[model samples]
Target: MTACDQARELQRIIDQQLISTMFQPIVDCQKGTVLGYEVLSRGPSDSPLHGAPALFQAGEQCKQVISLEQACLLEAGQSCIRHGVSHLVFVNVSPGLLLPKAFAEDRLQSLLATNGLKPENVVIELSERYPADNPEALKARLTALKKRGFRIAIDDLGTGYSGLKLWSEIQPDFVKIDRHFIRDVDRDLVKKEFVRSVINLCERLGCRLIAEGVETVAELTLLRSMGIHLIQGFLLGRPNPFPTAELSALDNPDPIGGGQATSDAGYLGRYIVPLAPTASLGEAWQVLQSSPSIFALPVVDNDRPLGLLHKWRVMEVFSSTYGRALNETKPVSSLTAYDALVVEHDESLEAVSQSLLEDDLHYLKQHFIVTRNGHYIGLGSTRSLLRMMTRSRVEQARHANPLTQLPGNVLIQQEAVHRLQQNNPFTCIYFDIDHFKPFNDLLGYSKGDEVILSLARQLCTVFNGDSEWVGHIGGDDFVVFSDRLEIRKRCEEVQQLFALEAATRYPEAIRQAGFITGEDRDGLPRQFPLVALSAGIVVADSRAFGSAADLAATAAVAKSKAKKAVSGIQIVSNIAALNEMSDDHKTTLLA
Candidate 1:
């Protein structure tokens, strides 16, 4: 059939029994489980417009919009029982389809009971494709539905016209992100950042976002990295004519990929672990330990995700300046907003890719929240981003050294100075790499050069991709310009990545040479058979120190104090950021 003919033919069928149901799963990016399925429609077989959307659009053109919607809803309600699908059934209703007669004439709840369900279990998704001709009438009809315990949702957020306006008029319980927004989100930085902004906006407006149309493992991970809670995509599960036993499978490893599949492909599948709004810092810390990769967790009540917790920041309060106050803290979200990304299942992948792209540029803390019909379900992240974030900053500091090819004193010092200058800040930072007269003596200048080179490469990749600047001071020392706010975090990151890389990159000769020549901190053989580096962080940032040399001298005091601290990153960030913090804050608030 011609496109025109096919379109007409499809409408005729949706008005009849040809409206078949297709289920897509919503996935949780955090626990990687399925939460539920969203029901979409399929047109008659052999029709050129077999997809539900096209079929419904055809109905509208033919003035049988109500008939098409009726068929789809009937199928959804009946299928809910035929398939024994106990999860919420999401059926799309165009804005043009909600007639005033819906309240007094139609008994939707009674129609639903014929399929063995309640109004609350059936989520009526309202599509924004049709402009609201009379918004008040629409509101009155929806208010009646609300009285009947029906949950309303706004479909295709970000793609629709005036999504915020519709949201205000309808006050939907959930908002499904358009499929176009979630497609191939893994590689794109701009789209993800944009979606993240939407997530933040939702927080202000009190709406939940469910990301839709996830296909690849990478895309799923990308959404999670950005703190998106709920998701739905082909990678999660696909709709089946009948209920599949695989929806609840938790321990099953996907044959296609080693990761576990919590749900069959396309139906809502995501694992959710709940957190209270007033949870203590100790509790948050425990959760952090349990899931190291997760930088934030959704704070929820019953089924609603209320806010978020910053995993890294919470830990900082205890060990840093707020040590005594750490235990007194409750729910990290009290201080930090758990703004989450939300999208719906059954969306086009192209849209998803765009959102992920935007997120890459949004903030340093990257994570995406996924939702189904605006209900909290999962999260998304870019794998590459997580790897970069978790990488050791200390080893990176070592590698940052400009002279020896490791991150040296200069870069480390700058970070320290930046910390002192931070507004909430207190002091200075000291950057140190170990004095290496012996390694040069034992391994010859060439091997020493190789060591420096490896460290340098690691450092470059760490700072170059994520932050603005890092400098190198000569030999075994590095400086990082940082605000006092997250000083040790910067240090710890360097330490972890440095230790890991040092183990991996060092030559076999260094591993087994058995020369008994290096400095020993505890008199025990070091894992790589060498002493570890020491860093002293003094929190001071002052432009009065005209040259890098002066900064080096100031760092020297902190470094001496760190000799006792030993083999760890220390931050004296309290001193530095007075000027820098004001500059940064002014720039940030103004922008």
Candidate 2:
């Protein structure tokens, strides 16, 4: 369409309120819950300005950005209420509109009232794309909005013309890192460091940071590891007019970083009274003075954590010449250590440990903030984390197989029981060597050890993943637990690879003949086939098994059947099938 035509269309959209608002979920990855929705406005579907870029471009051309934003705000609030969305609603506002004279406070209040929304429920998101001509006036107007209970956020933080200056002056309640920094963040060191710096800045400023435009699970996993829980992206959900308030039930619902197991670290947390970020250093000193044992105080704003304020740092500042007079009334946020480690209470101990080790050494002696769903819960010391980890490692080592270093029977049962409780479908594969006693006689015990190690390596190689586990069940038997549907194909690969490995252990004559002569248990000489793999697979979902013991017993039964089969592989959907089958019945074979 022509520029004039687009301008006319934009005018009509604003005048008639023809804007359609789509809600994109902003999820709290740690809690697996929706924190809120970001309202995305689009022009009418049939118009040339249907997409946001074209729509907003036309508004800029027509010099009606303020008017367009007002319409969008009103439409967003009404749509949110209509959809029964009571969660926090984030609405985008132009920086130009934040000027005191450009936008009226009563108009905003009236808009919220008409839509049944309170000031605290709405977050006015200002994009830094267009720098404010008069920042002092904009700050004054934003202060007024803050006084009225409305929260402020800076959108597309790094992509704007005015970057740190805007953040420093505004001290927004939330800051959204632009998508450029978030894309490929898992693989990009520079991007990771940049985001880490942004996180630190937000913590020091007592602002909540959000990562935008995350499209891959890798990106999500990495961001979660770095202490960013609030996520917005297509990976979670796309924008829709009627978006679901919650995420769909996933087999692996939580985004765990570093392939760490899910375990709550809440027990290590100690509740401490947090100081407001706006509180003065003098106020903090008094509190630190009263609590002699407390080393640091968390700086919080509206229940959201900013960072930790250490006592030594405060004393050093106060002890400086003329420090008391110059810095007594300054906000505690200025002295807060933004780099203090913050972890969700549900984070795995291993994941938290990895994060701690990766941080600077100074953090080793510092207290880390522990939060539940991004809200401050308490503080956890490094000493406590290390102590717990030491205990956990000792227990894990006790249950690990000595030779293969895989989980022993106790851990295997624990893993199976954990999967069963989650109610997610998983597969268990039982593997045993065929004619192993005869092979052991033909080859010395030393050679037999090599064969066993080969199989263990193959199983580990095949089943290595975040949701896959390998266990040594003693002797020549091994078991694998996997959530993958293609696990049978992997089992076949292991069988093929083991066949090659088995040939290496045999003499040339025996390898060529594909058989070895050895004394049987009765002392009679018999010819046994070359050592081969026998695998039995059980795919479990909601079947009623009494315990992990019963599951293992069923897998053992399947392995017995597989030993008699020509293809050397057997699969059953559940234990009922095996129980119903007679001794003469042939087991199900994988195609």
Candidate 3:
């Protein structure tokens, strides 16, 4: 069709309000919950302008792009209201719609208000495909929109040079990585690295990332490991007129890959909120004003935190003679509190707090800067640091088993409960030494304790990570938990290693015979098989169980079966029937 024909058709469609809106969920991959939905526009199903690309292309051609954009915005708003969507609704806005002539700054706010929505509930997603002639002016307009409470997102990131430039300039609250890079990301290490870098960059900028066009579980799982929690695409949920979150996509939980949790359970990223190194003191002042309770702000350039800006220091300067005029326009780095502590996100909170307490940098202790990969994220307060340190010490002392120096059942239960509440899928393995009592009786309690310590050391070697946990439930009974896909394989490896150690720990006679002479419980002489490890594993499904007690119960039943099998792994899952390990028991080294 000619531009004239297309324009006429577009006009007719607009006058009749023939556009349709669909929603696709952007899920929180970590929590297995819906974060929000991105509003997608479609023309009449049978029309030539059906898809957003075609519809908007025709609008651009007919010089009616602004009109089409407005229609989409209104339709999206109404649809969200009709569906009673309380979560954030992401709406696509053309740069043309931001023009002084075509754009009304309050248009969206008014439309959302009519639909019982607020500006905060809407995220304006602008594609880089359309470049504005004056980037600075466009940013200014977006800044105005931000002040009015709307969140901005750069859509299809990495698809255009302008997008990258816009990202650096605007520092959007969210960035949607284009599907091209996300496609088959799991299989492509380069893509994974690229995405990982973006995830890290987002963290530094304090921006949340949404991986768009995720089409496979592999891609989804890979993104989750990289700390990209917000996700979108067909793999998560297809866009539909009446959309619902496809939480089932999160059933396959993968191990979180950052690193081990430090003492005091704190990381620097949790405490950092950074300002650009070039940002003026006035800008820093505004930041402090907005977050009235914040004490300090980190000044950073390219992910590297240069120094901190304390609220009191800023106030002191502004209150001084001509101080406001002297510093308001100067770079935040000029007046930053260099004495404030700077620490990496992975650093032990305990060590950081100790360092701070020893320094005596300031009389009024407040907050410290936190960095991940050298980029500033936010500030951590002294109060939080002290509280976390005290809690960690108390919990460690109270829950550690004195015998093995490992966490006791209480810690294990607490860990299980926390994972359950997060709906994080994992495997729980209950391990008990087969014929342990006979060996303990033969060797005596002190020797038995030595064997137990050896086992504990073996466990520590296998499950030494933040995502994996090990606990001594007492005596020969132990529990292991992991949210990794390789949990089963890891369990088998542990068993093999344990079997070898078990054979070695016994006397030469017992090793050669593969059995030891011991008196049965009734005081009858009998030959007992050499010690072996039995593991009963309960795999958590996507949906959490009733409680940690439910998980323990399930694991207990599986353990019974495993023990009956003599020396092998037994697996059960809440979502499926009981599953037993393959008949191929490891090498039959013992019994």
Q: Evaluated with lDDT, which candidate comes out highest?
A: 2
Compare candidates 1 and 2 on TM-score and give the better one: 2
lDDT of 2 by residue, 1-591 (tens): 887888888989999999999999988877889888899999999888899998888888889888888898888878888888888888888768767474578788777546578889889888877788887887788888889989888999888687688789867888999999999775443576689889989889999999999875557766886799899988788999976644542123222212223244654566777999889999999999998978899998887888999999999999999998889899999999888889887677877888888887554645888887798877878787887677666766787788887777767766776667557788989999998888888778888888888999999898888778888988898989889856777888999999999888888999889888888889998889998999999888646565565677678778888999998999977767547545544233210
**Candidate 3 C-alpha lDDT tens digits along 344-447:** 65566656777787778456456777655565655677777876567566666676899987878656766676567556688888988889888888878887
Which is better, 1 or 2, measured by lDDT? 2
Separate clash counts for every candidate: 169, 0, 9
Count of clashes in candidate 3: 9
Candidate 3 ranges with C-alpha deviation above 4 Å: 1-4, 255-591
| Per-residue error (Å), model 3, residue 396 | 29
Which whole-number lDDT from 0 to 100 does residue 65 have in model 3? 82
Work out the TM-score per prediction. 0.43, 0.51, 0.45
**lDDT per residue, candidate 1, 226-296, as tens digits?**
67767776656767666432333223221111111111111222333657776766777777788765677
Per-residue error at 153 for model 3, in Å?
0.6
